[model samples]
Target chain A: MFGAEFVPLSLPPLVIGSLAAVACALPGNFLVLRRQALIGDAISHVVLPGIVLAFLVTGSLGTWPMMIGAAAAALVAVALIEAIRRIGGIEPGAAMGVVFTTLFAAGVLLLERSDTSSVHLDVEHALMGSLESLIWLDGTGWGSLFDPEALAYLPPELPRLAITLTIVALLTAIFWRPLKISTFDPGFAQVIGLPTTLIGLGLVSTAAMAAVAAFDAVGSIIVIAMFICPPAAARLMTNRLEIQILWSVLFAVLSATTGYILAGYGPLWLGADNTVSAAGMIATVAGLILGLAALFGPCRNRAGAPLGA
Target chain B: MLLDAFTLGLGYNATLVTLGSALLGGAAGVCGTFLFLRKRALVSDAISHATLPGVALAFLVMVALGGDGRNLIGLMAGSALSAVLGLWLVQKLTRHTRLAEDAAIGAILSVFFGFGIVLLTVIQTMEAGKQAGLESFLLGATAGMLKSEALTIAIGGAMSLLAVLLLRRPMTMVAFDPEYASATGMNVSRIDMLTMMLVMAVTVVGLKIVGLILIVALLIIPPVAARFWSDNSDTVALLSGAIGAVAGYTGAALSASAPSMPTGALIVLSAALLFTFSLILSPRRGLVAAALRQLKYRDQVHMRQGLLAIALQQPIYERLTLNMLGKQGLLRADGVPTDLGRARAAKALLDEERWRALRTLPQFEAAAARYDGLTDLEQILTPDQLTEIDAHLNRPHGVPA
Candidate 1:
């Protein structure tokens, strides 16, 4: 079933979307546990303006400039959120709503006001990135997967996402202990001199890193969905941090592959002429997984049976 | 040209759209105040995003039924159905699983919006005539709106306003203190649901004009900006609605004046401008107010310390204290204390002594609790109490005790 066209047209986006999903889902476990899952949402919104401004300055859609601009905007958003919360005496959610919405509006306004009409940088493109078109243009067939000449022409997003996934996994592994302590009991973490504020900032920064990268690869719907859904669904499966992370990875990969195939072929299977949005399908799939977990996962209840230590 | 648009001189269609969005913005503002107060402001975000699929599906359904598929009412019905489903999922997940309300919000918004995008792509591939309007719902399209759609938005906005007016009392009480609201026999959850419904009504109505991305900005920005002006819930709601209306009017007018300006983004940027101004300059809760209060408190501290230094015959070295004391004509050219300064100094020193004794006295606890170094001693102690305390000082200078 997987033919020559499939290798070049479908396989790259599938791999890139999965890498993006797993990258976001890793830190998502801690974010979900810490009740800060929406950081991904907030970060994704701000990335638009950053990408736009980077294009404005460099006048190019090169990958690195976009990433840097996105990272810078994410930092500004984090700072702005905190400043508004403290200065306005507003709740975190409201402050966050105010900041991200304003920034997103600004991004939209900038796009309209600027002369970037010739580029592929519209609001719809920013939101629902053309994940289906990130094709491996140089591939010939299955054997091209190992041919260095063929691999050299792989879509740029694959290596970028792979690197981001590595960084996210490494950060989680390095700060596993402090991150766990702070997420579970911040007060005790504070008493133990863990610099809870810095730890919290670090966690948000890690999430931002993953968010900006995944947003680059798969658009924002996937970024936001992977950040909360996979980790959240896994949270119901077990209370153990280690197992939860592993489960989230499995779920994210499943959502990405299944959702992409559904988007690419499900319409044809059902006798339609065209495919649907891969990002949206993946999000829909993740939500289904979450619904199932919410309904019948082992530790789905609020007060799960205590660990039999 | 811009002035002409703002004055509603941009012809019939633009005028109708401007007025329509103004009403929508105003209604959103009123509901947003209650939502923000209840800490459920972000819930509106989830609701708005979830409406996307409904808009797309509503179009497809209309087309399949042999209709043109651009009916405002049909699209709104579709949007409302999907939004309700999304909201129901948020509530269910928050209640059933260990997922926090925010996590549920994030999940529902992304998934539903994603599915909506899928539907949107499907519609794009269809050979329909009027399906072009579907994309405008993403960010809203005020330009070129048919007069009928604009009028529907206007009427919908007015009805939502009336609804908010009627629901204000229960909403205010429920938003501020849900426990009190529930104890008073009001169904708090029902009130919250109503508030969410109001937000959605405005969202659906405004969707044709303002788009999905920025309608929340209208709902959230005005209420937040209004909050900087007033602490009273009712007043904030009133002011929020006014701000929302003005922002909508201005944003629409400005966009109408130009070719490339998108209506929804301009409207939100206007609201954001208002928020920025309020954050910096509002008299009650703004940064300027907070800074002024801090400066005044600092002045009081310096004045008190300077007086005490003058009384103790100490050479004051702090420039701020010296400058402030001199500004009040309490210092000579050579920096010696004047007669008025000496009298002030003596009172200041005596008050400091009185504060020291008051801390040890059990009977004056309430009076002593207000004893910041800046509070005048007489403001706390009665004349009789001061005389009794002076008698204990053993100097007995003020009244020859």
Candidate 2:
């Protein structure tokens, strides 16, 4: 049944999830184009130790410290991968496997050793977020937005995600030219004095920030899915960078909203009593969208588009 | 205390788990050599993550069929099937569509894990599913392993080891050069599939021990570490197996001693430690060895250059070079080239001239082995004639020297 409690419980997650999805998908397009798609997965995993270390130092799970720590960790992961590849002559994927797993294992060990009960930060929650419990019911209906007390009662995650998404959008729009040039043709971009390396690093750091912001709400798995799937699907649907970005945002928002709704209510419709993980559902839905696009999209048979382009 | 723990201080279950994990690690290392050679390290990661949903589905089916849902064979069968399916999807996505291998791998990994999480949530809601203990598949729970499970791992490990041994020739052939294998009328695809099957078997069996997230570390770290020690594929495979076995044994023993440590992470960290050691200190292809070789080569080149300069009547550049060459009986103390030094200097000068000429010629650019063809270089050009040829080559294409 359409109950009063469902609307208040489901709305905030849907909004936060979509925002996180859009934020991640923006930078994901560049990563896919540059053939560094797995870097997102690597960054997401390596940031675990950073988040845990930040919590240890600050004694609180504040956004700035965690974001800064996670960004630093992601950069360290990237640097280590490069160093291992150059020094040891190991393949990039294997180098990534070595670094991220060790970092993640260290994070897990640290979390287990520390008293994480007070911080509500455990390995399980780090991998799979508690989206079902993010209920926003401080005040009911649209009238509550104007009330000062109700405004203060808004779910903290909503604002953090919104601000992160806005920064991603603004930076993406401002640097769209260099990002596109560097991603498509770094040699030419360098020849023209575009600071391609700097742009590339900035893009990766932005992705890390988005990843850390989304980690608390949707978990790292969903963050990785959003980072690759929507951009990849959008890539299959379009060739122009602008249209691809729009399509990516569109696919991400749709997946987030639809996956959240389905996770919350789909099981009930199927005569089950419990809801599933919304973050996992979002990733699955994003994947499903990608599968459909890969099959039926106009660029499906274009061999050079996805990776080589 | 450590000796006792390694000897027999632990109980029977702990000892059995340690031995079983060591066997599993050995098999995984041997199988991983081929995968690493083929550059499919991340593919194993994808398959491991993709097995999660199959595990959940198998448990659900077993429960439905009046079984305890913990049947290891049934669960492994389901996991293998899904992992192969995931591999097929990766192949299809890469071959038929425009997605690169990494994108395909990332897509399959996240999606399958997502579905598995959904199924896990569903299972948790069921009546007896809390006892399923499937969450251990994420990070592994070696402490909770049963004797029967340990036995199964041992048998599975031995079988995979036998498979790798039996198919070593074809797997190595296909891994290093598939085109050559196919050219020689071998079924490269079938060999590749067989290797995948062996990998799948080891991976599925290892799920209860190392879990999905860290399982690829077992597949990757050992072979890579072994590569630092030897160039022969057979030696590499053998050393990888040995390193993996030692890592497994020590990690399990340590975990048994310290009950608080997670066995999977400890095992991976141990392998990583071995990898670091090999990377820095292996006798061949290691950083330290390479740096030492570079220094020795530099010294030899410096002595030879000094001899050549002295023979050519150029001013001596370094007193250390002169003293070192004199100590080596190649140079006179008066800074003049000795007869032995003169012969060596003339040979080195001819070699340099030949190298410069060959490098400047674009026709010889691709053939690195062509340098060996210049055997009569001394008869070909004297020092004065070498200068003339060098000047001629350095001039503009249409201009006279």
**Tens-place lDDT digits, model 2, residues A1-309:** 345555467777888899889999999999888888888888888888998999999988887788788878888988988877887788888888878877887786677678888778877787787777777787575566577887686688889999999999999999988898899899999999999879988988888888988887888878889999998888888778899899999999999998888898999999998998888888889989999998887777655354434
The Cα local distance difference test for each model comes to: 0.90, 0.83
Candidate achieving the largest DockQ = 1
* Model 1, runs deviating above 4 Å: A306-309, B129-131, B313-315, B331-340, B394-401
Top-lDDT candidate index: 1
True contacts kept of 1: 0.84
| TM-score of model 2 vs. true structure | 0.86
Q: What residue pairs clash in candidate 1, if any at all?
A: B139-B211, B140-B211
User: RMSD of model 2, in Å?
Assistant: 5.7
Report residue B80 deviation for candidate 1 (angstroms).
0.6
